[model samples]
Each structure stands twice: as structure tokens, then as C-alpha cells.
Target: MEQLICLEALSVILGVPIKPGSKGMSNVNELNVENLLFSTFFGNLFNGGPGKELFVDMNGFLDPQFDYDFRYCNDKSICKRGDEPYKRPCGWYRFALKVLNKYPDGNTWLGTDGWRSHSVAGEWPVSYHGTTIENAKKIVKSYYKPGDREKYGRGIYSTYDIDQAFDYSREFTSKNGKKYRVIMQNRINPKMRKVCKRQDYWLIEIPEGTSAAKEKEIVEKSFRPYGILMKQV
Candidate 1:
């Protein structure tokens, strides 16, 4: 059966290896820097004035004096709830729409705060697809340190927990009378907040004969709760 892996969970199983020349930066650390600098500035700039300005990205926009934290716009209305509160003409939605329309070219100016404001440290999930269970296990083992290898004896370590969030299997008979089964797995990493768990997911497999359009539709439906996303490697 084919296996699906969460990208972030794969990192944890592999001890969250820091990239070469990364200077020991973790995802949480990067998220912090993003929130402190970019989010604080753009958030206020858009929500501060009337909701009709195109946010140009040049100049000394990073100066702290220009970094205003408009607390009024930071509520769940702008970040979470999806009703009248979110659609209010004077709300962050209007501000976001204006920015998006003006810069139909791209969202480099529209930082990630609007979509990911609810996702805090530890709650973020990563994922991968199209691999085997044995291969996945081997990949995780490859990241073990010398001490860890010595202690755990090669590919059998328990330092990290692999939460097999979903496992689905179904059998089908093709027009040629050949029988096949599709197996899919969704794996999630440990959450940042113990009480407020996040449903991080990655699909493991699609039945061999499924069309590309069907596969896309399946993944898109699964990914909606997490917001608009691009295909993950």
C-alpha cells in the first residue's frame, strides 16, 4: 500500500534537522519573526486607514515607528469567524479585498496574517505524499544522531510519536476484471496547543485508475479547512 506523510511530521520523526547554514532557526522562530516584523506593519497599514489604499512595498516600511498594531482589527472577526463579522464593509475583509484587487498581480504585500493568524506555534502541520511505509521509516532513521543510533539500535527509535491520523483502504474491480486496492493514510504531528488540536493532513494515495481531475478535487476538499494552499512536495 502506498503511504502519505505529513511534511512537518516527517521532520519531527527525523529530529527536525536544521538546514545547512540555517544558524539553528526553527519554524516557530521564523513564524515569530514574521509576526513581529511583517505582520505588525502590514496589518496596521491596511486596517489603519480607510479600506481603499494600494500598499506599495518600497521605501523604509520596516521602521518600527511606522509599525502600528491595530488591535481593533485583530479579533476573531478578521482571523476566524466567517459570517457577517468577517464580511462587514469596514472589517479586515474589505481591507484584504482592496489589497488583493489592486495588486491583482500577486500577494507579496498581503502577508500571511489574514489566513494563518489562527495557526500558532506547534499547531502547524507539514505533509508529503506518494511513498511506502518502509521507505518512510527508513527516511526517518536516516536522520538519527550517533548517540541516538547507538541507543536505539539503527532504525528502531521512539523519540518521536507518529500519529497515524487517517488510514483508508478500498478495493475495486476494473473493466478488465482486475482487482486492486487503494490505501491512503493521513499523518499529523504533535500540536503546539494541547487543548486546541489542529487537523493537519496529507493524503497518502488515490486508487490507481482515478483521473487527475478527481484526485485534485479530493485533495482540494480535504485542504479547504486549512485555507487556500498550493501543492506540497
Candidate 2:
């Protein structure tokens, strides 16, 4: 059997060294549905300790109430209820595609029972509270090319400039012969209003040909473990 690669192991493999205090992981308290989804996906890919698993709360992911909240901000929280803020569909779709591309198997196995239970519906089919698999799949496919941006407009906040995003998109080729594009936006979280130092939103485009297995290998070999001869101080 192949060795399971955990997050710490992946860190050593990637050579993208992370210090103990590094902000590699986001805060769960501030996590919205999409953030949680991404976290769960990545966490499952690398964290392989006993009783550790990755699971999504279908209720939270698909609930129309929460969906509306996720898209808009009410009160100080960006994801508060009753606030119909504009959501960039293109960005959301892009995120889903990246995850699907990375985890082609769609194994959906990771994390503890508590996590798993919240992730699926009655029959073990991965179901979000109010979202259909069709919608999810549709979202993933929508962001395959630059043209899709017409529907959602330019992203508000992105780490890479437009040119870089376009260039990155060209590098990856999906199984279907389609290229990838990234749409980023800047979002203001009211809760963090006091700090007001962090930028709103920055979306990164995941180039094509990047697979979950390849990422796992990268994390395992380049990120997780390194040869270090320790010296006593």
C-alpha cells in the first residue's frame, strides 16, 4: 500500500517550508462554506494521522439561507444572513474546478466520523443541504475559460494581475482540452473591520495538468519531511 501523505509530511515534500507560526492554514472561526470546503479538501489530501478525516457539512454548503449569507454580508460578518451582497460566480466555479482537478478520484474519504456524517446525506451520496450535484458540477465547468468572465465581470481581488492570470491559464490543459481561468475579487469582512489591514479577496488560478496525486507527491516529497541534522543549542 502507498504511504498516506499528511499535511506535515506534505510541507516537507514541497520545499515550500512553513514555520510553526506560519499562516498556512486559515482560521476555522472565520471560515465560510467555500473556505471550509477548500480547507477540507486540502486537509484530507495531506493530513493522514489516525482518526483524522475530511468532511463537509452538506447543510452549510448547500443551504439556501447560508448560500445567500455566504454571497452577501449582514452585520459585521461577511457571511451573515439577510445580506444580499454580490457574489462572483466565476470565482466560486474556479475554486471548485481546482479541487476536482486535484482530487480526480472523488474518493470522499477522510477525517473522523463526526466530520463525515455532516458531509453527506442519508445514503452516503455526497449531498449539500440545498445544493444539487448537478449545480456543483455545473459550477466547476463554468470557469474553464476566459469567456466565462463575461457573466461575472472581472474579479475584484486577485493575487496575480490579469496578464499573469491569463498566462497561468494557458499553461494547464484539462482532460477535455479546455484551459483554466481565474477570477478573483476583493471582499470586505465586517468582523475584521477593526484590523482592516488584510486585503479583501485574492483568487489564484490553478493551472491545468495539476492533479491531486501530483500535489500529494509534491507535498510528500518536497514539503513534508526534510533532511535536517539537528544541533543542540
Candidate 3:
């Protein structure tokens, strides 16, 4: 069976060789920087690895600002659910970029607010819905009822709806197979009665002889040398 490499593994692969010793070395800093650069470059090259699949769901990450408390040194509550522990969307995107760079021809999948719950507290829209304009429109249209526009005008739903719509629009399918759909909430948010940011997905049809795991392995191994990591997280 082929092995799937993750960011840590990729980091080890890229960082270990350059360093003379496993122990502390001042020059290790430089090597680390170099590794990071290499990783970033590799990520950009592959563009999030081969799958041609996009999954849309609620943002699983947390809001960095309000979700934390710096007042107490050992405050456990400071780290809200899905905040400190996970790498979150930013890291996920970086990792994804690496995968994409390796598998440029693979399909792209996207989910709704699966990174962070929609909010109005950040500079960039506090949502992970749409990364493109067309997607934004689709999200809005899908979520809001034709005449219930005024309700979501200024609430979190306003921003959330826009972001989700954008993501939906950006999604594309290269080849048809089984289109998967996941609905987190049956009804739309009350604030935005028309918008429903549900989760939907689809996987490309693998060749007849290839198993799903085998195909994933083949793709993962292809990008291993390029410093891109591939694994189920």
C-alpha cells in the first residue's frame, strides 16, 4: 500500500535532510525558513492535490478574536471549541495549495461555513463560503427566499449568505459521477430566512480497475518528492 504524507511528514522530509543534527542548531532556523519557503512553493505548484472534489459545509474553525481570552494566563476557556487545537482554515488552505500544486488537474471542492461560524466581527467577511463572485450570488439566491431579503440585511446572515453564495458559484465538476449533498440545517437561519448554507459534495469517477484508496495513494506519491503532503485528516 502507498503511504499518504501530511504536512508534518512533508516538513520532516524537507527539513530533516538539510539539518546536520536532530538536536538544536542555530542554522536550523535558516533551514526551517527554507523548508517553509519550499513548502509554500510546493503548495502553490500543486494547488491542493488531485481529487477534483470540493466539499461544502459549516466552518469548523473558531473566531480567533472573540473566541479567546488573554487576561488569564491559564484560562482554559480561552481556547474555544475548534480554535487553538486545530490548524484552522488558514493552515488548511496553505496545505491545500501544496496539494493543488502537485495535482493541478484534479478537481476543486468547496464547502459552506465549515471553517468558522459566520460573524460580523472581522475585517474580511467572517465567513468561509464563497471565494468567487459567481459563488456568492448562488449562495445568496439559494439561502434567501425571493421576497425575504430585508430580514438579513444587516445581521451575520447578511455576510454569511454572501460568503456561502460565492463559494457555491466557484465550484465546478470536471466529470460526473455521484454528487453528494449534506444539509447541516434543514431550515434557513431565521435572520436570513431564505439562505441555507448546507453541505454538498461530489467525487470524480475513478477508473474501473483502480480502487479508491489506490488512486489516492497514486496521487499522493506523485507529489511526495515535490514537498506536498497528502493524507486523510
Off by over 4 Å in 2: 1-37, 48-171, 184-187, 191-233
Q: For each candidate, how many residue pairs have backbone atoms clashing (under 3 Å)?
A: 5, 31, 44
Task: Tell me, by TM-score, which candidate is best.
Answer: 2
Which segments of model 3 are wrong by more than 4 Å?
A: 1-43, 47-125, 129-158, 162-168, 174-176, 179-233
For candidate 2, write residues 3-93 as lDDT tens digits: 1111222232222222222223454222123433333433432343343333333222222221211122222212111121222222222
Better of 1 and 2 by lDDT: 1
TM-score of 2: 0.22
Write model 1 residue lDDT over 1-233, tens digit each, in one string: 00111222222223332112123444322211222222233333333234332222222222222222222343433331211012111111111111222222343222344344243432223221222333333322321111122221221111111122112212333333443321111112322112112222222233445675765444332221111011121
- Alpha-carbon TM-score of each model against the true structure: 0.17, 0.22, 0.19
By lDDT, the better pick of 2 and 3 is 2
Question: What's the candidate order when arranged by decreasing lDDT?
Answer: 1, 2, 3
